[model samples]
Target: MSTPARRFDTDVLVVGAGPAGLAAALHARARGLRVAVLDPRVAPIDKACGEGLMPGALAGLRGLGVTVTGQPIAGIRYLASGSCAEARFRAGPGAGVRRTDLAAALSTAAQDRGVQVHRATAGPVTQDADGVTVAGIRARYLIAADGLHSPVRRGLGLDAPVRGAPRWGLRRHFPVAPWTDLVEVHWSRHAEAYVTPVGPGQVGVAVLSGVRGSFDDHLAAFASLADRLAGVPGTPVRGAGPLRQRARRRVAGRVLLVGDAAGYVDALTGEGIAVALAGAAAAVDCLARDRPQEYEAAWTAATRRYRWLTAGLLAASRVTPVRRALVPAASALPAVFGGVVDALAGHSDGGRTTSARTRWHHLEGAR
Candidate 1:
């Protein structure tokens, strides 16, 4: 009663051609599985993001045989009115490429590796003992990387509602020469603006806050940065909202969820791409082993770091007194701030606490 292998359209059908979906297609094809990826749009798509790739993210992309170009980011810097702390990446530098550049590179890589590219939007999914079918293609297994508002997730009853006050992101690019190698985060009472050098003569600024007004209004929150790009020509603003999404379960039947479709937290940490790529690899690995259920656990472990860190930081960022204390505390204990930034950069596993600092320094400085 076995169906002929040729009868199947693909071994794995991935919906959405964004970085996560394309990454999944490439990874699946590498394992010798026939893969097809579907998307509703053409290549070089753009979206709102912090756009700073941490060192780990850059390395992961190269591992999948992808090469992209952008400005080199050496580290991260946090600044407030009268407080500042910074850290340099101990692993290596990360790139700050635009979303369009990344999408183009990934699309080319997927085609080069022989992944079937379908330019169609996937509709309601129907599955049986044979497999899952969507948009006329019958795939033995399905991977949904369709993004935050995934129709596949909804059709499959996998969506989960998130609580708390919603936060959103707004981003735009400015044509101005880079001033620093580090990605600077300018925090204020109402918003946090991330300045990423995306090219030698262009920088992308993203602001995160409770739903806000014009980009000019958000830019004004960062006084010094606002002054530098006062009238610089910029790209049209792109945005994403309420900033959090989740799934009831990552794996259900022969289908698995990846990227924002699987779940998402606030983008305050800039780890979205890295975590998505990891989930893509993990989901494909499960299919390769014919143990699709194991992907749930794998997904959990893969995203544990991002989830915990973003959650804790976001929760702290919400508290009035604690939020007010952040920059001052970071400024007072510069070493601790460096450690946290290094952890975020994938240098230390967030395990190397600053308590390791020698007491001799304290005594010497006291004298």
Candidate 2:
């Protein structure tokens, strides 16, 4: 006797199983929606990032039931050619975790919640108002959580809302002592590097800003820092080419876009994972209320202004004189500069104190 064909149905379908995709899956499940997640990778997708989650991200991870593995970074450290400053808040926390590990953890959490996940080499998604048909499975709603170059976003004919200036990033892991408990951004004429302690004896370095090269070449400049790695050899390196910060409109039309697919902010701020996770929750909220239209406004309110602030900062980094003038001034007044940093870190709700924060030095430090 022949067996009857089986049918698979779900409330929502998510593409790409990265942090953004996993977050969306978890959120959708939390909202009582049956979810299906598709990705090309098996469990964890290796990503090149600074490995630091801002406070905003910490909150998002918790909401999604994803747990980080290290002590929180209390604040951020800024370094310029001749000046260095640190921003610390009594309440904020920053944690470090490898991207692959974080992705695996979140993916597992999503699965435990009953989300149906598929790992396929390549099977494009065909989405419509009724559902998304991939291979043979169907889902009522589709979500695009793919990364910067998302095929789902392209298929939907949506463009990124904001465009980022050209910049490249080379990421590598080195066995080195902790430079500081906080994430550190070191700026130079050629490039800028971000250092974070992700493991007990491991630190991740990401070089962004100028010349594009391999991780080995990128670490050459930080000789003093590299020396620490001699005792503990360097691990394999990963790199992401110049990133473009773009967000899309119409994320939901019987569908939703989360994480890098919905929008991407410059990595200079190191808040991409947090944004993706938070965006996922917001998308789920809209879908639960039967108002997918709310996602655009909600996500924009959450991330657009932050993107603008990063643009100003990137521009500020371009001019040597401006950078020189701003560093000392910013360092002298922590409250002023730190507040702006905090805002960029996603502490503030609506009003951005960029000007107030940036010009604080001109107001009080010039004297």
Best by TM-score: 1
TM-score between candidate 1 and the true structure: 0.92
Clashes of 2: 4
Instruction: Give the per-residue Cα lDDT of candidate 2 at 219.
Output: 60
Task: State the lDDT of candidate 2 residue by residue for 1-367, as single tens digits.
Answer: 0111133377777888888787777766665567888886778788888888887776666655567787457788877655878887555777878888888788778767788887763266676655567656677667778778777777767775444347778788876667678887776665677888887777888888656666666666656545555556767777775577454584646777777776554687787876676677677777767678787888887676667877677778777787666667788887988887787565332221222223323433554
TM-scores, each model vs. reference = 0.92, 0.85
Summing lDDT over every window of 10 consecutive residues in candidate 2, give the lowest-scoring window.
349-358
How far is 180's C-alpha from truth in model 1 (Å)?
A: 0.2
Q: What lDDT tens digits, residue by residue, belong to model 1 across residues 148-262?
A: 8888999999988888888889999998888999999999887889999999999999999985788888888788988899878878888888788889999989999999999
Which candidate leads the pack in lDDT?
1
Which stretches in model 1 have alpha-carbon errors above 4 Å?
1-4, 347-367
- Cα RMSD (Å) per model? 10.0, 10.1
